[model samples]
Target: MVNRVEVFAAIRRDARVEGMSIRALAEKHGVHRRTVRQALEGAEPPPRKTPVRMSPRLAPFKSAIDEMLTCDLDAPRKQRHTARRVHVRLIEEHAATNLSYSTVRDYVRVRRAQIDLAAGRRNEVMVPQEHAPAAEAEVDFGEVYVILAGVKTKCRMFTFRLSYSGKAIHRVYATEGQEAFLEGHIDAFNEIGGIPTRHIRYDNLTSAVSKVVVARGHDPARDRVENSRWLLFRSHYGFDAFYCQPGIAGAHEKGGVEGEVGRFRRTHLVPMPVVDSLDELNEKIREWDLADERRRINDRIRTVADDFAQERQLLAPVPVEGFEPGLILTPRVDRSSLITVRMARYSVPARFIHRRVRVSLRASEVVVFDPDKSGRTQIARHPRVVTKGGQCVDLDHYLEVLKGKPGALPGSTALAQARASGVFTAAHEAFWANARRRLGDADGTRELIDVLLLHRHLPAAAVEAGLTAAISVGATSADVVALEARLHLAKTDAIAVVEHAGAVGGAGSGRHLVAQRHLDEQQDVARDVVAEARRRKVVSLTERLLLDPAAVIAGLPPDTRPLPSVEKYDQLLRLRTGTDNHPAPPTEQARPARPALSVEETP
Candidate 1:
């Protein structure tokens, strides 16, 4: 076949040459006579005609439509008049006579070409080389369905793409909360190796805008404006945000990211990815994303990885403190002497347990601080365990307090039950007993003592108040005795008070007041001591049985047992030794029983 460019060139040449017969040239060129005649005539081609009008009904409003197109060609397509709108405007505003709606519509259709030609604006070409590298980035989120731990879950996939480099990053998250949004940026920034100089473009995602800024201030006029409050996050992260006009127009600004999201889902997150855990799946996806850095782009000589390396040099360095995306709340200690943080329990030293403390929360940890202290001591730290209503101090911290305060052990049924369950050790019991000795038996004192016990886990300063309170309440040996008597169905307030005061104050206060107020308490303890000693004096068979029944029955053994008559045993031993001061000879020592052995076993 002859080339079309060559054929067109021949036709032009033949026309330029003077007078060869046009018909002969046509036959020689294997062209039609009419085509040769037209080429020779050098006539301007008649303008291409439009197809015949489908509807004559739109003819009357042709002039109005033409005027609208010419005046507001650049206006949004939605704002331009449709056939129905033109019909309405003609009847209402123009007050035109005898203009039916169908006639206006048909007229507009017939004049469509003329109207469009009049409306057309000149187009400008944007040279690609004029744009600099890292000028802008497009960001968006896509939805990805992933099987995590055998459960299908939907995740928001964050995508970011550099306009010039076409380098991109895709990340998946369970939610698009603020933390996740910020995290996605951090990841994308790292993947790109730097941030784009131009502001990021995005659709009006809720993460970016709380409310669309339709207007501002009182008696406001409606206009598109940046939502200032929502812009703070972008400012904090050191990025300018260019929000697209709400919906589809904005979507075009981030078209690169849209394509990247789809590509990532298909390449890295698709075909029903299954894994033992979500973490593992994410790890695999991250590896794939990193690997994409090495893949060469279609038109670019450098790989995405190489472009990202350059971008890294251009990006702002992350602060040494790094980004903290979780909400931080400051809560005072409740009257229960506990601070609630993230629905988990933690103990402050007894003193600050009832006072206000500051709570610092991060995504993973919650720290309670004693702001009153000069150094801002961390009174408690706990894993964040968000609950439905509110957080509780850790029960384990409270348990440690119980373990520290032996006296408080009696007040906590839970502690006592736990001890009874054989979970507590003998050493723990011993320690608790020692604490009870130091603190009095009063409920407040006991509670304080328990608080003091928390010092074992926290700081001693925390429980100082509990210790002082316990001591201030006449929690002496005498008070303990009074409490014991009361436990055994003895009620004597006067005696109890006197005994406690005396015990706490010591003999410096004299015994007279104590005797009058706590005579019964003192007498009871004395009686108990005497009774115990008397019981020890009256030895039962059970106590004596292990002492050797045969020896006791016959008479105490002279050598192997304690002598029933000490003087008699001493005299005999002395007589045998023939020296009152000398010890018995080694041969006189008692022999143990001999072992029986078989002949082969006997060496």
Candidate 2:
């Protein structure tokens, strides 16, 4: 059962050590005399020759098959004949009815390559690469599935990996379009704190490639037409893009990232990630990226982080001005207070209904802008709706209109969505119910709407706390709720200010005492201000004018008339009081009287 090499070794050892004759070796090893002689001549056995089988049935068609293969040389790579096609053609054209398909297929396979070789067409070869630190990087999108909001959803993982360090930044996006593509680069650049100096390797993704302009015979990368937005993005970041050739031929060009995407997916995203949103999934990916810094790739000597530290400094500094990676659209707000972006509807302020609003559709969110004399102002922001016909509504946007139609508040879609999202909390519901019981449905709903409006000027937590406080005190008035919210906000601000002052005022030595004293004085001033604000009466415009007419007039223009004085009437008051013996004499006599005309005389 010994192998040939072992047999040869044994034969050589026995022949040399025992000095046995050829006939004796033959007798001992059970081989013929000539075989023994050959073994004695050389310890190593000669390689066994492979017999070339002559196919009688296929020999007649060999010339035809060669001609077909030769003609295939000029044909498009994909349009060339397969082994099966060659077999079929031989039977059909030459009437080689008895030819086995396997014989014709095998002959065609070897003969085709021989023809191609003679014609100077060769298979592609991959060269091993040694990457320089911070010189180059690769970007790619890997498809992954995640349980998003309890639904199995497909997402794209955008990966940007440094060639040398293998430090990667990953982001999950709902779409792999141009906006997400650009945004991925921005996020990676910001995370790495710089850009790769040479170029980033990428496949001709549609996001970056307008078209592959080359014919099949030409080099795809050289003849590609770059996308305008992609060109602008590359110019802004000051990096070059080295697109891989189209299809499988180009896949090996960015092998680093191609392998990296699979590796990361297997390592981190193996168990399909469960997340409420893409943002959450991306957050987890970022954490995984940080953890990956300690890992080594292949036979690397240092950790990913160690190599990245050295490479980081060599990278080009990122530009100061940030790029907006969102797609801008001007959508007319529909009558339902919604604006449609990419087939999904998102609610804007009710006032924006029937008006054209500018929307910035980003990877994770939709932001609507309202333009005025003061410039563009952000009116609403909602998490992007991924599916068509989906809607994202904000209760606050409809609160103003709902105030007028209080009954609608009970069954409005916006309110339901608000409740589902925990924006309308238990405290809010409690306050609303209490208000309804105390004030009846219409007035109570109006009060709830007013409380909701408080969110515009106050923090949500403060407003919620205010609602809870008001409910505890059996107060259904929106004013009382607003007052309570302000109180909560003031408390929070005071605590924050005091903590900030303490932080700014350092510790150690007599200087600390001085800082503490200054802080105390600041606290005293703040308390006095708060007390003054609390004690001051809240008044309407009319009451303020009656109480302090001078103050109001002082704010008026210089050309404005002065307010009339009541001092002239004080003389009459003095006579009535008997404090002054002023003349009450010039009554009707002193006053000039006008003559009366009788219109009835003419009639």
Candidate 3:
């Protein structure tokens, strides 16, 4: 700016004092024609003018805008008005028709700082503290956006992060409820192998806090109290709770987990993770947790997993079996053998219809229980589904209904769901088709029902294998399929028992191998109960034969070879000497009694 001013002044002096023409000055001073004419005509480039303009349209609304901005100083930061919001208020409240958004924006931008200054604006300060090893942790919930089944969806993620090691656990949930909250903590404890000995910090989440009183002082204990269920959950796990203030103002209190949620979602869920089910998504979450073992913090010298290794040694061990955070609902099964939950249908057993049954709804599974004359039995369990109006059906649940209406079996929702889940295999379809051709529709459907009932007693894989074998051999009867199924179960079960026993001890003993052969010979419970007795009898008889081999040989038929007669020769010498033939036999030590064998026979 100074150089430009000096050059303009020099051009004017040369043009005026040297008596140079305007055209000559333009060429001599390297100035534009108009610049030389203006310089020659003006006095030292008349001081730059300051212009002032007035907007009559916005004059009436200025006071109202100032009032709104002043009121915003006392309101929550997030609730503060933007320039556009102020413009909208001006039009709606003040009837200011001619005011544009830009006019309000310019004024608000210029005057808002004065409003904040009058309200004493200050930046929040945070104190940094060193985290003790295995002494504390932070817990919080955050929203996570994911691509589920090609559809973009949002879910809540419960994050638990250790303060010392920066280790974290992330779990995605369809809903953020008390059960999911408690379950996340329990799972984190179980994963890390121990509970933090000191306090666990939490945001003032409704899941943990029932109310937050404003009268109490800085002590969180007096200001906020835990909900009844939350207190019970904390007591069961044997941990202390630390509550942050009830809003975004105290977010820094548990910022470790708050930041963890964002960090993990950005690192693992970027480029959008597409998964078919929540379980598959959680499996990927576990993989991310394992992968974090190799990651180091920004200024750390070692991996987070290594830091956790040190903190883990100081952690308090949790009990082997502990609390189960799940909701116990008593929802009656409808006529369709399905129960409505969260606006979706989940199948239970047909026998439970119209009857109130106990349903244990956990984070992942919906387990149903039915009461009978004997006791309560777990009838069925299905993965909890979140899709609205979606149905989760089991073929076994409708097998009894299918038997009465074979035509319905062909087009039942249960069968379709089973096929989609891959529980109803191609082998089942093949067997059903073949049976239909051989025995007609009704009888074939009944046969399929019988095969389905076998699943209650035998493993599904065994039953499927049996169906494949039966179809291959051209055996169409349900009895043939059942027999093959039982044979497979017996064979596989025997092998399992042998392998389990060998694993319990050493494999070189060969005792398990011998027992496996004996087990394969019979599958009846009564035979198994007497198998040990039979083994003892054979051993006892062999011992007696060895004790009196000469006498047993003398009693044998002539075709068999006889033992040596050493005892007879000793008897002949006694007879010649005429000594007491009944003299006491030379005393000898009795063989040590063998230890009793232990057997746990199946009833």
Per-residue alpha-carbon lDDT of model 2 for 147-260, expressed as tens digits?
A: 999999998989999999999999999989888899899999999999999999999889988888877787657677888878888999899988887878788888989999
Estimate TM-scores for all models: 0.44, 0.80, 0.68
- For candidate 1, what is the lDDT? 0.59
How many collisions per candidate? 21, 0, 0
Q: Write the per-residue lDDT of candidate 1 for residues 1-603, one digit (tens) a residue.
A: 876456646777866784567777787789888766665555443344699655453455567777765555667867876778777777787776567777776666756556566555333243343235677888888888877657776767777888766777766665665556766787777655556677787777766666565654632222234545346556665677777766564455566778788877887765878875444666787788778888876777999878766666666654444454544466666545566654555455555655677776543356677676753577777544433343434333454455456455455644554455443434334434544454434434454344433545443332332233223333332233223333322223334544565565455335477554465566567556545533532122322444688756676435776557667787888988888997644453575556999999898
| Angstrom error at residue 391, model 3 | 2.5
Between prediction 1 and prediction 2, which has the larger TM-score? Answer: 2
CA shift of 352, model 1, Å = 16
Ten contiguous residues with the weakest lDDT in model 2: 536-545
RMSD (Å) of each candidate, 1 decimal: 23.9, 8.9, 15.6
- Give the lDDT ranking, best first: 2, 3, 1
Q: Tens digits of per-residue lDDT for model 3 on 1-603?
A: 355466578778997689888788889877788777767677466566788768789888888999999889879888999999999988899888888888889899988987777676644567888999999999988887778767888888989999999989889887788878988988799889999999999988888888887664455433776688888888887889988776676788888888888898788888777897777998989989989989988888999999999999999989766786877788778888888877888998787789878777777677777756332478888887767998888888887777788889888888888888788889988989888887789998888889888888889888987897777765666777777777667666655665554554453346577665554444344345335323431112223355797777686668756766678777877887788566645545655565666675433
